[model samples]
Target: MGDKAAGGIPHYYLYGDQEADVELDLLHIEPIRERSGPNDWRIRPHAHPDHMQVLLVKSGGGGIRMEDRQLPIPAPGILVVPAGVVHQIDFDPGTDGFAVTAALGCLRTASAGDPRLATAAGRPAVYPLAGTGLDIPAVIDTFHWLHREFIWSAPGRRTAILAQYMRILVVVLRLSIAHQDAGTATPDRDYDLLVRYRALLEEHFRSQRSLGFFAGELAVTPARLNAACKARSGKTASELLYERIVIEAKRYLVYTESTVAQVAHLTGFDDPAYFNRFFTQRVGISPGAFRKQAARSEG
Candidate 1:
């Protein structure tokens, strides 16, 4: 393992089976830390442009930090972090766990072979893996095999490792579905909402801002949907919906040279004044000022 200091943090690039310094090429797996102390494990916020990771915590507890949200560590569970999601993990300082990371292409190939596996593209994918004891052993076996292949780092090892990774993905999907059927798993309301709502908002946030529009499509009353959202997240359904809209506005303001009126129209606002007030209320800055600041920072 090679120790490289990246931005004041020590990265112990440890590989038990392969030569160290082999940059993360498409897919990789490694043990972050073994059982050590109550607060022994720590990782600063990080983002991977083209990599996704799956974390399996066999024991101990901690928390996972995702974009603007924090999820309590569900020990003995599995976690998936898709690409482009800013995240970090803090385990019971002495916690023991292992994580596997693979490129998006690798995930697709794995999913292509098995209809049971689910593929989440361009979004943070987090799933709990502890409910089905039936599939647990198989998942573990596949996980270890991938890790070993990574460590062995022999010629043409990636092809074999990728195959094993796909097999585990299939087992995990089946186990999750079976657990849901048996009512042993907690309702994945937030995840289900995130996937479905995000897609709807992408298509309709411009023409519709009413919560009722989305609630109706989900076959739940607005109040019911609001409660489910509030239970999973502190935010109400409307608040979450508006948050997504505001986020889009910010992105346009920072990345485009569009005028305020152009931006307002693009984000579904009929009036520039209304859009300005909305943006300022949520972001604490006027759209024009925000754009200028971002430009200056980039420059």
Candidate 2:
């Protein structure tokens, strides 16, 4: 069971239980072919609960699966798998690449104080290194350097290796966010407000659903807050708040055994009936039905 996937999705410590006897905070680097070729170039659906992974595809192509979604992995690409995300990959025969698996705590430490970095470290994504406004060669070089340091630990090697690891993460974070924003530049003040508002929402969505309260905390009027959200995302502030709550509701329903009433209470709804109505209106399905459908899909 240790090597097997939990719920049919393998739980791994660098593809197996290698970390079971070692320190939890460490990094492992190796060629993709080392593990994939021997296994027919296909990695089964699995997750690393305490680690995050970065795969650099130098040549050839493949497909990456993050939960129910499939993504392409072209040559000179990067795939990031955050901790606890079920993922799998299929590489073309003879595909060449490198993979780095690091402890999640190490990444969290590196990403601290940077919201964008923290966000990137919390999601699974694939990015094409070419034409991404990122320094492709430099990133590849850093990966190579880290691989060397990992294998040939010399004086100050651990610090050097982690510094390179942090560099790769910073580059990946910038490109990921830039791709999401799609080059749509926002004014500094508007962007700052949006970021702060989102951070606050993440913290208080379960207890505070009032748009006015959020705006007041940010020292802005409700109207101005709504305007900023609209200008940046084409959605009003209230819509965003409702969407966040709904998202959390869905996550709880899908990932946990929480009943409708429990989920309602967890998502700021004092009345189960009102929570049911709100979820049905926005999601077009009752919470119980949604959970059942999700279960069937997973099965």
Task: Identify the leading candidate in terms of TM-score.
Answer: 2
For residues 147-219, what per-residue lDDT tens digits would candidate 1 score against the true structure?
Answer: 8888895877868888887776765565455444321212245545644555576578888888999989888
Q: Can you tell me which runs of candidate 2 are displaced by over 4 Å?
A: 1-6, 181-299
Poorest 10 consecutive residues by lDDT, candidate 1: 13-22
Over the full model, what C-alpha lDDT does candidate 2 score relative to the true structure? 0.77
RMSD of each: 12.3, 14.0
Best candidate according to lDDT: 2
lDDT string for model 2 (1-299, tens) is: 34443245556777755433222346889999998999999998776755778899999888988766788887898888866566778999999989999875467557766757767755567877888788888989999999999999498997898789889889778778666742111224554576577668867988987898999999999998887665443457887688778877887898799989999999999999999999999888999999998899878
**Candidate 1 TM-score versus the reference:** 0.49
- Judge candidate 2 at residue 218 and give its lDDT: 98
Clash number by candidate, in order: 12, 2
lDDT of 2 at 133: 84
